[model samples]
Target: MTGSGFRERYLDVLASIYLYNEHRGYTSLDRVLDAVRQRCPDDAEFQAEIAKHRADEEKHYRMFRRWFERQGRMPLQVDSGVGHIDRFIQWVFRCSIEELDTSEIVGSEDDFERLCRVIMLTEQRGYAQVEIILKNRLIMSDPVMKRIFQIVHKDEPDHFLPYQRWLERQGRATAKWNERAADWCIHKILMLAKLPALFLDAGRPRLQRWPDEDDAITAH
Candidate 1:
């Protein structure tokens, strides 16, 4: 492929990946919100913050969906394999998001604390990534994509603050060294292995529908 061809493919794959992750993020936050509501029923402030965070995630997801719509093409099909929070939860809880027992985590202080740490780390990693992408030449080449990422860059910092503040209120460390190490390793593995594989596979299948299609149906 020519250099321009390669760059186009790279942006498509990158945006698809971002779209998938954003969808996964808001959906996963549903579970986290559930846990927070149950565990901190009286903490209205915290619940409101989490609600806003979830809303921001959904907004970002829609922005990427609109970007794909403008291109008149579906995003590439992607699953939890490239999802940062999916891998992080699996690593920490030894279970997939579907298998996670929110009740169990909320029932134990230690478990809830660990969950907060995982979330904080994941959000921090996401913020850091958006920082890099905002400056990326390839991402900047597409004005719409660049604008989507710019919004994400603006909202990214606040995404982790609620969890970090909760941990601080509990007098617990925000993130352990090992968890940070795991986050670094997971990012490397996705960037080095999974992403390159997607970029090289020119015939990769695309999603049949938007990730939020089902939610839209239910909302109606």
Candidate 2:
């Protein structure tokens, strides 16, 4: 393949892996929503927000399915490997929310700040990694995949900010040092586990030529 063609093909593989992780959300987020709801069992607003996030995650999964189906089959695997990561992050979020719930009673803002720190680390901090992959055009080449990344990357920054504002408003953003080690250690491990999937199936040889739209119809 020509250099540009090789680049596009390699990127296409990376895009496939990214889409797999994104689509895996259907199951992963279901667990997260259930856990979050359990954490805030009596809060109707919390339940409502969890429902909304689940809806968004479903839409994202569907979008990925549409694009992915056009290229090939999916594994239908129950464990996308990122499930552990998602659950841990949700657990952390739940901890913060739970802490925020009690903050009004004792006027302690520490949990709220920790929550923002986790959010900033996971969301805004995530961009540092994604930007490296996305900017390397050779790592994700399909037009549809490119569009998806651009759309997602555009919204990434905005999602990471609210928790910080929430912390400042609640007067918590400092580190507690003594209690911070365990969560941070776990977060690091989950993140490291999640990052490798991006590099899989890179440049595997095609077993067959791209199918024509009419070919699919005729076969059907």
The candidate scoring highest on TM-score is 1
Cα error of candidate 1 at position 145, Å: 0.9
Going through the candidates in order, what is the number of backbone clashes in each?
0, 2
Clashing residue pairs in candidate 2 (N, C-alpha, C atoms within 3 angstroms): 11-139, 11-140
Question: Per-candidate TM vs. native?
Answer: 0.96, 0.52
Residue-wise C-alpha lDDT for candidate 2, range 88-115, written one tens digit per residue: 4445544322232432322334443454
The lDDT per prediction is: 0.91, 0.48
Model 1 ranges off by over 4 Å: 216-220
State in Å the error of residue 122, model 1. Answer: 0.7
Top lDDT prediction, candidate number: 1
- Show the colliding residue pairs in model 1: none
- lDDT of each residue in 20-129, candidate 1, tens digit only: 88888888888889999999999999999988889999999999888888888999988899999999999999999889998999999999999999989999999998
Give model 1's TM-score versus the native structure: 0.96
Measured by TM-score, how close is model 2 to the native structure? 0.52
The candidate 2 region of ten consecutive residues with least summed lDDT is: 206-215
